[model samples]
Target: MATSWRTIGFEKNKKLFERAIEGGELGHAYLFSGPEMIGKRTLAVEVANKITNISVPDILMITSAGSESGQTIAIEDIRKIKNFVSIRPYGGAYKFIIIDDAHLMPETSQNSLLKILEEPNASSIIILVTACPEALLPTITSRCQEIQFFPHPRTIMESVLAEAKLSKANKEFLADFADGRLGLVKRIIEEDSFGEIEGAVKKIMYLAKADINERLDAAQKLTDEKNKAGLPRLVLYWMLYLRTRLSEPKAQKMLSGLLALNEIVNKPQYNHRLALENFLISL
Candidate 1:
């Protein structure tokens, strides 16, 4: 599904690209780095939208999957990008490739991508999106135009939450409670059973103090409550929870491990139960 510039939360980012379009200064490659689910991916597609005349051309999206599903990005994925952009556009100005969770790429994949970045084709643009930019190689980061996405301020978040159909009081509470993640806020609106992430965080605190057996039980219990498809969003909830408390030394430590855990969860072949157990056991 395509998203409009007005639909996503990043009006400023939309305008930035619009200016770039007018000035004809768009780069061949870009890096959209920020927290998980904060409209980074949406904005990347929207940048494509600005030039596509609402008829989005072949905008290839590369992302992670389980080992059975080709695992994370491989050298072959880069080859696909090479083949995709090499073709001359029939109508559109350029081809676009948006790589979601690009930081999950293995070293081989990253090295393969570097070749594309070094001699980018003018007829195509690549956008690499990730929550953990630090995980990407420095060479990869240095070659692209890095755009940093941040959480929305309270007032802006309130407007984004308006689509949830909540009352004034409920909206205000969620605006602050969500801690500026537009994606988390949108999830609560779209999923009736999603529950409050704050409640999930509270459970995390309790689990942290529990016995190993109890903590392990809690991990399965949580996963069982949601279908496997929800795992990525579930991971984002925990990430956002830890992200809000980065000033705390303990949370800062937990977030580092959470990032590595995040990389594997999207892969269907990975054992999510054991992964969650390990996280809780380490606590």
Candidate 2:
């Protein structure tokens, strides 16, 4: 039988799980921290499945409201689990609550959750998983057994790409741009759209040389396709790339423009297209 804590390509974590099983030192509250898509949630859920004696598919996966909702574990969802936690385990040794992207929880929610962590029910185990653990409350962090997950070895990443049946060129591209993130790699493999963003980046750079009208046109095109939330990130990366390519004075100007653009993009009332157009024109 496949164990719930068995994580793919996580040899070190697997050993840790084995040791926990051997020593009977299973924790009631665990904080699993790692880069996005490095399998922190996967491992957490696997452990939860094991403790609950439930099939992985039967595990209730709840999330927040947004495009990234599937990944955002919300506080309302957490509250729903409180009653469940109060009860005894249904079929297994414990009832497990795996909170993915726990850092996304609001301060109010975290405070609400602190009470549960402070005095957890005997049969309940809370597992908080996040890429940005620093965003979580220190009090919450103090109450949990922390586990760190690192990126898989390059060899392991290469093997995973190979198994996905990607061409050599695409595999190299994914490996270079994935930032040690398996979720990013999986996205590239599934959508085959990674290069589209690069093309958009190139267009933005090209616009810097064109007239204001051309720049505005390019900005509108890029923002329309990528959305307001994503445009600043692309511009930020482009600015970093330009800094390396241009003279010091030119780079400084571009960096300042980027900072200004960032400020505009962050404003709730700013029109994304207009802000992007102004930034592109200034560039």
Candidate 3:
């Protein structure tokens, strides 16, 4: 298969696109949505190369210029792609435009891209990659075929960790801490503090099972002003822990709380500290 370059654990996604190609039903634009480091960009690039039969880096690749601290995909970037796609492919069946972290494109940039999607060139393909699709306009999503990437299965994660020569004990710990997010696991391991983080998570898990006052005290400490930067990581660890406890009926009851906590942390308007504290205290 042309998309064989896709990383492990994306076989199903590769097959889906393969089937689309076989049926001559491959869409002009595709939205690849998922958590960070789940192979969305790799799959998108591989699929683009396959469909275009082009391997030229500069001619076929169009990447978004965005940053974590709120730099967005600008209108100028979209205009460049708009003009590029209008031209015929240099030496391929299709021209490819990939917008990484596309959800960060400001509303104006999204609107600008919408125009291109509306009048897509016959020999061009656009792929939008994002972790948070809800941030994108509905019109943009509605116009493109959506592909979702999820966390890898435990078996695949274990294989990847093994390839990296991680110890068996560390592999088991990361497999749980990452909740199937291979990129996160890799990052944690490279940081040399995975053991410390793991220990802290275990202590938090114990607090989750403790009495109300004890839980509240722990939450207060976790959400302390100076420790604010770590709150998100703390919440993520708890979510991973909660995932394992889902088989328990009592744990199942906290799903709503988890969702609420996740929402509060993601949105800036909410007092995330208070929200997290309330959720943890309740647990």
Q: Which number leads on lDDT?
A: 1
Give TM-scores for every candidate, taking all chains together and pairing residue i with residue i: 0.77, 0.71, 0.70
Ordered by lDDT, highest first, the candidates read 1, 3, 2
Question: Which regions of candidate 3 are displaced past 4 Å?
Answer: 1-3, 58-71, 189-238, 241-258, 261-283
Ranking by TM-score: 1, 2, 3
Q: Across residues 185-283, which tens digit of lDDT does each residue of candidate 1 receive? A: 776777753465666677777877899889877778756635555666666667767877889998887888777777667543468778888888887
TM-score attained by model 1: 0.77
For model 3 the local lDDT of residue 56 reads 65
Local distance difference test, per candidate? Answer: 0.76, 0.68, 0.74
Give model 2's TM-score versus the native structure. 0.71
Residue 72 C-alpha lDDT in model 2: 38
Relative to the unseen true structure, what is the C-alpha lDDT of residue 155 in candidate 2, on a scale of 0 to 100? 79
Residue 20, candidate 3: Cα error in Å is 3.0
Candidates in order: C-alpha RMSD to true structure: 4.8, 5.6, 4.8
